[model samples]
Target: MFETELTRTLNIRHPIFQAPMAGGPTTPDLVAAVSNAGGIGNLGAGYLTPEQLRGAIQKIRELTDQPFGVNLFVPEQPEVSEQTEEAVAQMTEYLNKYRDKLGIVQNPSIKKFSESFEEQVQVLLEEKIPVFSFTFGIPSLDVIHAMQQQGTVVIGTATTVEEANHLEAAGVNAIVAQGCEAGGHRGTFLKSVSESLIGTMALVPQIVDHVSVPVIASGGIMDGRGLVASLALGAAAVQMGTAFLACPESGAHETYKQKILASNEDSTEITLAYSGKAARGIRTAFMNDMQQYPGEIPAYPIQNALTRDIRQAAAKANDSQYMSLWAGQGVRLANDQSAAAIVKQTIDQAYTLVQNRFR
Candidate 1:
């Protein structure tokens, strides 16, 4: 019953998108399950290597023939100034305390910080994936055009109307209107994080008015209620992350899934501790301690690499305090059902709402 430009353009039965959550939660099984259920499932390939990305794409293809998307992080060359070096040193020393507690070695030798983004993009081109999406910043026009040439729908993430305008001018197929209530990293590339903190209700319609392309509303959206409200506000579709974190297909740690089911709306907070970028997650002891640190936090990928060992070790120990439990404010509504059930329930509820309430 719910069909819009996004559904028609993407060739999907529903206008729902499973937000491309990076790390472990967005597994190929999860992605394919959503597509099989009529929603577009997205693989968050930002941290994946070229070989790993190819393997994942193959895995997804094996599971379902439906269209799916792969999301990448636009690379940022953080200026390595003397101050940045100092901050890295300070943060490294501070994070050592957590290592000691987790019973892991301190100050492990670090060589590589991030995966090769260019090689990752090349895989997408060669594979001719159905859709390509990115966050943090826009890709070059050449890259965008290349994706279009291959008939792959390209989507960009935006936190403000101005960002949406910039993306439209750059010739994107669609723009995801990421709101302040979104979980994980903030995709505010145009303005300071504090300035781009617009809620979904306010951000979606303004972006829809500014840009001619379809706008996908993200952040804090959980159920059929959010889906109908976003459509009412001029959104062509809705993207959800936290809503799927607790799904059985999700690769999130067992402890993390439990936390999502047990937490509430007030349990999450945005912090720069886990990765230098500001992202929302359920508040933990690590985040609280980092808040009191007198030194500046290193830039993303740097800070992300520095704390990798700690997060991994905590996972092995089944300790939730140090893991990056990325989740949105809609934690109270998260379910522990299968991915197909979640998608079906959402569409059914949306249909009921439209039938009984709208008409």
Candidate 2:
């Protein structure tokens, strides 16, 4: 009922993709389950070291022979100089409050803020992943070309039409049009995050109009209804994260899953408190308290690294207040079913919808 060029090209049965929810949710089991169910499963490899990334790919391959994707964070090299030390110090002191609450050390030593993108890309190239996608910004032409040469279908994230255009020019096979309602980090590279906060309904078709590649609609899309709507909006497929977040196969913290089930549409807000970069998640004490901080938050991996210990401590203590519970506005639609069940239900419901309405 929902076959499209994407499904044909990717050799999948359904036009659905399990969004790559980095930071543990996209477990090998989860990715394999979705791929086995005939949708492309994506491994969020952004946080993994090269060894870990290679291991994960091998694990997913063992579980499913179907095509799957691996996603990476396009490295952001924020200036690290004397000029930024003051802001870093101010933010560190402010975050220390959470450390105290979590009963961790007052201050922690962080040797490195992020993994090596070059090394990670080398891993992907070595693996010859079926699909390679990235966010934050475009990778170098050499990297993209190398992946394509290896027969990997490449995809890029875009928040605006301009970003979509840029991705197409860079030779991505498809572009994920990420709207404001999306969870996790904002994939805004070409413009200010504020300037790029377009809704999915408004953003998808615009990007589809501007780009020659397939447009994959993301953000707030939760069910069969969203899938049908995206197809109507000229999207070749739908990439859903929140819908699969609480599934049994997902590796999201139990407390985070509880919040997803309990929270409603108004529960989430965009906050830089957790990750430095803007990302949508269910609000908590940390998010609210950080809003009053006078100092500018350190950019990206800096803030993400500084808060890592606190988040880990909070998780160990079974506290959701400090963990980064990334979920889109479709929080109300999330469930704790199995990954295969979610895929089947979505396809079944979409089929019924198409029969009843589109016919």
- Per-residue lDDT of candidate 2, residues 136-239 (tens digit): 99999999999999899999999999999999999999999998999899999988999999999999999988888899999999889999999999999999
Compared with the true structure, model 2 gives a TM-score of 0.99
Q: How accurate is candidate 1 locally (lDDT)?
A: 0.94
Clash count for candidate 2 is 0
Local distance difference test, candidate 2? 0.93
Q: How large is the C-alpha RMSD of every model relative to the true structure?
A: 0.9, 0.9
Error of 1 at 206 (Å): 0.5
Q: What is the C-alpha lDDT of each candidate?
A: 0.94, 0.93
How many angstroms is residue 357 displaced in model 1 relative to the true structure, after the best TM-score fit?
A: 1.2
Give candidate 1 regions above 4 Å deviation. Answer: 79-83
Q: Going through the candidates in order, what is the number of backbone clashes in each?
A: 0, 0
